[model samples]
Target: MKLKTTLFLLFSILGFSQQNNPASTDSIKKTNIFKLGEVIVTNHQNQETTNRVTSKTMESQNKMEVSRALNLLPGINLTASGSRNESMVTIRGFDLRQVPVYMDGIPVYVPYDGYVDLARFTTFDLAAITVSKGFSSIIYGPNSLGGAINLVSRKPTKKFEFDGSLGLIDTDGQRSNLNIGTNLGKFYVQGGLSYLDRKYYQMSKDFVPMKNEDGKERDNLYRTDQKVSIKIGWTPNKNSEYALGYINQKGEKGNPVYAGSDTQNSLLARPRYWQWPNWDKESIYFISNTHLNDKNNFKTRLYYDKFKNLLISYDDANYTSITKPYAFQSFYDDYTYGANLEYESRFIPKNTLKFAVQFKEDVHRENNAGEPVRRFDDQTITIGLEDIYKVTAKFTVIPGVSYNSRENKQAQDYNSTTKAISDYPNAGKSEALNAQIGLFYQFTELQKLGASVSQKTRFATIKDRYSYRMGTAIPNPDLKPETALNYELNYNVQFFGKLNFQTAIFYSSLTNVILSISNVEPGKSQMQNFGEAEYKGIEAQLSYTPIQKLIITANYTYLERKNITNPAVHFTDVPNTKVIGTVEYAPLEALKLIANTEFNSSRYSTSYGISVPDYTLLNGFVSTKVLKYVSIDAGINNISDRNYSLVEGYPEEGRNFFVTVRFFNSN
Candidate 1:
């Protein structure tokens, strides 16, 4: 459907729904979300600059993956790495390496590249996902140059609870998940398991044939993922609590070949036959919160995370044969261990003070076919202090500062010509200081205005400073950290009991950006801190419950990014404009209908000027309660069957259908 037609239909439905009978309210209680992982800031008027996506929202939209779920929020855009077949999201034009990801307050990004494939993170076990924008809390530790995303797990508050779902996608795809938990006053336990698999996906009928692809089912479009999670908690008293958690995820996927017309002599556009035989991660963590006295509280978190993956490249589309020069196998084994300690005190009246210290160590080991393993190690430390002071009944001030340092303990250099390995020279060390302040004014009970400015820094990842890029790049261990100064103004207001609106204007100035400079040596590039950039954006969100039976929500974002040092170099993958709208209507208590639409403006696919065309998508779903304890949902995504690509050559799935049945019982 056309964008204009879709919007008209949405509003037409809203107009027709006004005459319908009121729908009954749902009785399901709010799921218990873990609070220990949250960054505590001033609670004045609850104006902290954080957005959240609850489990209910994920279920309503059928967003089974973290990346897709996050896209529902303003200022966040979903993107794909076609060559790697990995899903990612950018926040206000910043990539995942700068935004970072966390599970229960522990960093989960890959230690080497500082990125995690969000598609591999299933949403079945999460209670909520929280995103903090530019003005993030300093207590989150280092590397939050853009923002932070935290996945909050569920905690059992009832004696017995169970939730499970089984789903079928297209014809061959399948998905299933189960979550069970129990609480016994002082002790509680929760566990979850989820699996998703798909053999192939069909392309839109309008998709034109290319050298590497034709109409119908796309080649090598298969994926499988499985995850298991468990947590145990003990509450000794009202003032003390402890928890231990474990999570494991396993996945495998194939990369479809390039299907665009830019294939003449351009290596970047060449088709690739790539597959990931193994993509796995595991994490174990312990967290504790204790109240020292009426004036103070302390918290601690300790975690160990491991990641392993294997990539195989073939010369052609054939399933076998790796004898060609472009064919090879790569493997990575990485791990990280970290600890955080925080103390909060309210000894001074009308003031809250927080102190936090964090330590982390990362190790990366990798090798190619017939090559010896190369290893790298690094250590990081951060100390932060923040205070929330109430200046008056309607005014609040929050100020924070953090000191961060990183040291490269060991790095191995491999010489392809000699087949020899040696220690890398000039082991790098770096330090940075970050500070931020926010001012908030509560003009009235239903209106608030806030402003904030922050200075953040991100250290170069191990790969950034030392990767040879398969002989195409030189290792520059002396690369400095990248920094960004951010400014934002936000307003929140409620016009009526059913209407709410929020808006923000944000700007960021980036300096010493890490960019790959060509021809540092003959035919080789080097990563250096040599670029400057600016990102400015405006975001607005609105929600209205016209009546008890109908609700409508919409969000829009406009972003502009400029390369100050090189005007010719364009920012890739992030759309200049994005809009999303959703409508939920319940004509009956047991039955509901939902429709959603999304639009994205054209975006650069490569720094060399290639662009992906703009597109709009429409989706619809029907949900109904069957038995007293069961519910069923049927949905169709990309109702228009329009052919669209986030990246230049990678077309997304089209006109897909899904059916899900859920069972739940809580007491």
Candidate 2:
């Protein structure tokens, strides 16, 4: 017998006994304490949820990447058991690609595939990372079916401010970052630069690779990167502001050597001779806002991005075999243009309304042997509106709707050697209409309840409808947009002002699901609208402080996924249950310690008869202020060294250590 959930629904009923009077003093102190599954956006206070909207000591976390930091949230998983290129953040059994990333209100994703590499984004210049799960705000543009994630950058208000850090890892790696900003009365300037050099990380002692691929440690897994960015802003008055920004980034990484077993061996070829030669990006943008009064306000953003990636495939294992050792190069380029404009009004009492329009276009080019093989464009236009109505002092309602239009233009696929076009070309147009409604009620000073029902639609990506998927899948320009009808319910309870518990349950019905299955030929798949899916899950988080300087938190999620079109089969990448626990303790005024534990249930890949068993991991961190301007941070990841694989053949790195020395000004 197998257990589907850790704890049954009884925990929901038991929470009622813990509700108590609200604590005003402790509430202010809790403002900087980042709680699990808590919304941290700085938007207007709404009746849907209540908590601190800002953090004063966000820099204390010493986060290198956003993926690991976000893993602490309920229902958010950084599962390593999949392809490294896949989005690391999974929400309620939905792929992260379905969750869009917004930077200062601009959506950012790979125009060709709709994937965002969360690990490549550093947290050095972030003000906060805001996440909105099911029934998210309508202001976020299209392709946000599962939810939305926003990386809010910082704004400088001082004459001069600078923050920098340098870190060293036991795995022969180094990381350095610098951020500086200044305010010149009416004008402001800010800039940041970061660099990372890392080598192959060691695995746990318990992990042992196959005979031929075995080494003292993981092989051919190293990365080097550099990034630079600048932003200039003008603030004429308290109610108006304008800004311009530019960013350039470059990266080179080696794919891990693929170890194979007798049962399966797809990884045996590419991992041995191919590597990413270049991954580069350039972006320039402008943003402006005007706040005339509560009755009228406006904001707009315009941006252009250029992305280039290259993969080099070698003809020989030694890479330098004396006999005409040549290599082949494949290139992908995307030139993207996007703009967004929004208007808000409050002409009626007890009501707030918002309207927005957005435009986006991606011109893509694929080249092999220094010759163009494919050229296409993806474009979209959207209009949306939402209103918040206060029906009573303790009750509120929100309703929203959006219309989207998308088209693919000038798509052509031709052979590099013969210059002959493929018989089947991809070009099409599509449209979708989405709507949602939400309710929030404050039952008491210490408790609240919220629920929402929404229908969301996500458009197809360029690769989703065009790419061959390396011979495993064929192109299909007729693929339709995927849609999901989501239902959500949540409850919040507070105890003695120092403890809090939040629980949520959600169900989603997905239709016209686009999937790649064996339709083109035996053992091969084609992109098509082939299946229907349903997902339901329950999640809960607890935050409590037993003492003045210590805090402990825990969260868990139980999920069920049904392939409505085929109930006997299960999805390949999701786990059945997950639990996370953490402790933060400060024994001295200048010292702080943090520890965390993560557990995931086994996963089954039905098509391949592969099962990755359950596993648990532990990590620890310690930080101390050594001087007025300096702090030291040291930590060890995978302290328990339980050898495991999130994605089969791609084992998790073993115990590793890192130390950082940070510097900043008092102002």
Candidate 3:
């Protein structure tokens, strides 16, 4: 009787298991177009696309052109005089200088003048780019009140590969890049080179007014850029890996007209002729990084840079010539050195702890052809600790704090007047402390919620602290640091493995905000902790993949920046609305087509003054593989040739055409 009972129980259990999972007993296999439910370690708790700003994954096409990927992020804008290497990025409500840029854990902003040129590095080597929303993470140190951009480069891989690409745009621009890498025994070596050249391009629009005597408004542009780099890595044992990298880059750019504008002969009014000046920049960088075990790592970087630029103005009234040249050559040299060390500990199974310390020193000097040279030096140190505790399967909390101290030094010498002045009076030291807290909860398998609160600060830059001008509009050597308090909330949900959506709301209260205000013509502006500000906004992103061959992505932002204390004065640096949409289709196994659209609301040309017209841009591309080892991509930009300007004097490119070919070793 006991044997019979055991057999009966076994058979009942088998029948129930099969009933609950019928597919498990079948021989058929199933495939899915959506994998929204799958996530990895690097994926954060804030799943809402609108609640956070992020960089896309590094891939074959984007590796050589990192900015291309950055162009797709929400609420981000780029200002380019002409060259891709001469562009500036602005995000949220801050300028590029306000948002600190870092590479492999080292600050990339030049120390001599504390200015960063985004075009110095090749995007092909990057593994990822992460933007921390409004000082959300203090691990990068002080001076990041607006936010921070961290670029992580590719590490040594086990495979050996070679990749190359060539491209042409419009009638004048051309680009070529190559990458090669291999792993040998316990060491790895990688190298890359890139070259770019472009001639002047004509505007697609008819900017010539019938009554105007001035020449037609052309795109007036010229640019040349080149870069070479090498990296070596060693992994003697399984517990550690070390990498050494070196890179050199140089470029020259020129703009003949008001960069890009329909205005007539505006260049003639300047002291130098309107034949705008040409600019040249060069830089070299070296870095060393180490990965120790799984919980500790460190990185050190050293960089040097030199820049030369000329300014010119045209005055036809002088008649000696259509353009009079008042030449001014400014020379700048800078040295930067920094290090970062990170430690992670998991003493408790359910809790994780992270701590980091960073230090940096910057020395820079500026000189002219006939006059004096000024020098500025600064040093900073920052440290922070963050703890994450998983209270339960449904709840998690994280809290962090950071501190920083900075010191500045200056010196100057005059040659034309045979005089010397101790500008050291403008040098001083400052300190700041910040904190943040965040919480996340999963309500259901397909729904999640999160919130974060943070306080951040930024110090005055070298240009704002010691740059000398004509009069009492003097640089405030005693300027205090800027600070802000920010709050954010986010929500996310997925539907039937077909639609993925996310939304977020954010608000911020800022104090000691810096403003460049002047009372004179050509306004002499200085950095001042002028007043308070309030920012509130909504962000949303929706992505749908209904089938294996089609994907659609769209994002929108409705943000308002205002001065609550002085509502009469508006902060016009950011647009009130922004939208981006993209559709990609895979027609066959090797053919693809993509369409994109970008739109932004009206923006201010001046501080609460002149307003720029709103505009929309359209672009599309088609790609195909002709051979197993080669592919071609063709695209069109500004399909309607819409005329627009991001900066008052700089006109954006119009209706441009481009073609690119890529080759790789199939083996």
TM-score on alpha carbons, each prediction: 0.94, 0.89, 0.82
- Most accurate candidate by lDDT: 1
Sorted by lDDT, highest first, which candidate order results? Answer: 1, 2, 3
lDDT tens digits, residues 75-167, model 2?
776754233433266788777668887666667678888887776676666655667777887777788888877666666655665556677
TM-score-best of 2 and 3: 2
Ranking by TM-score: 1, 2, 3
TM-score of 3: 0.82
Candidate 2 C-alpha error for residue 121, in Å: 1.2
Worst 10 residues of 3 by lDDT: 25-34
For model 3, residues 1-667, the per-residue Cα lDDT tens digits are 5325533543333332211222210011011100111111124542334422322222322323444455566646554433222555665666666677765545666554445556545565454555666635666677777677666554434245445567776777777766666667578777777777667654547343222113233433566667776777776766445666666666665444443233333332332223323344444455543555465544444444445444333343231343223444556666666665656667667776767777777777776555566777788888888777788988888888988878875545343455564555645678888898888888988888888888888887776766655343556667778788888887788898889888778887888876665663354666577878877787788989989899888988777788755676666545788898989888897788888888978776555555567889898888787754457778888889887766554456678888877554411
Model 2 poorest 10 in a row by lDDT: 1-10
Model 3 regions more than 4 Å off:
1-42, 45-68, 79-86, 112-115, 119-122, 156-158, 206-220, 237-239, 259-268, 271-326, 413-418, 443-446, 469-472, 520-525, 564-570
lDDT of each structure? 0.87, 0.72, 0.61
Compared to the true structure, candidate 1 yields what TM-score? 0.94
Which pairs of residues have clashing backbones in candidate 3?
63-124, 112-364, 268-314, 272-313, 273-313, 273-314, 274-313, 274-314
Identify the superior model by lDDT, candidate 1 or candidate 2.
Answer: 1
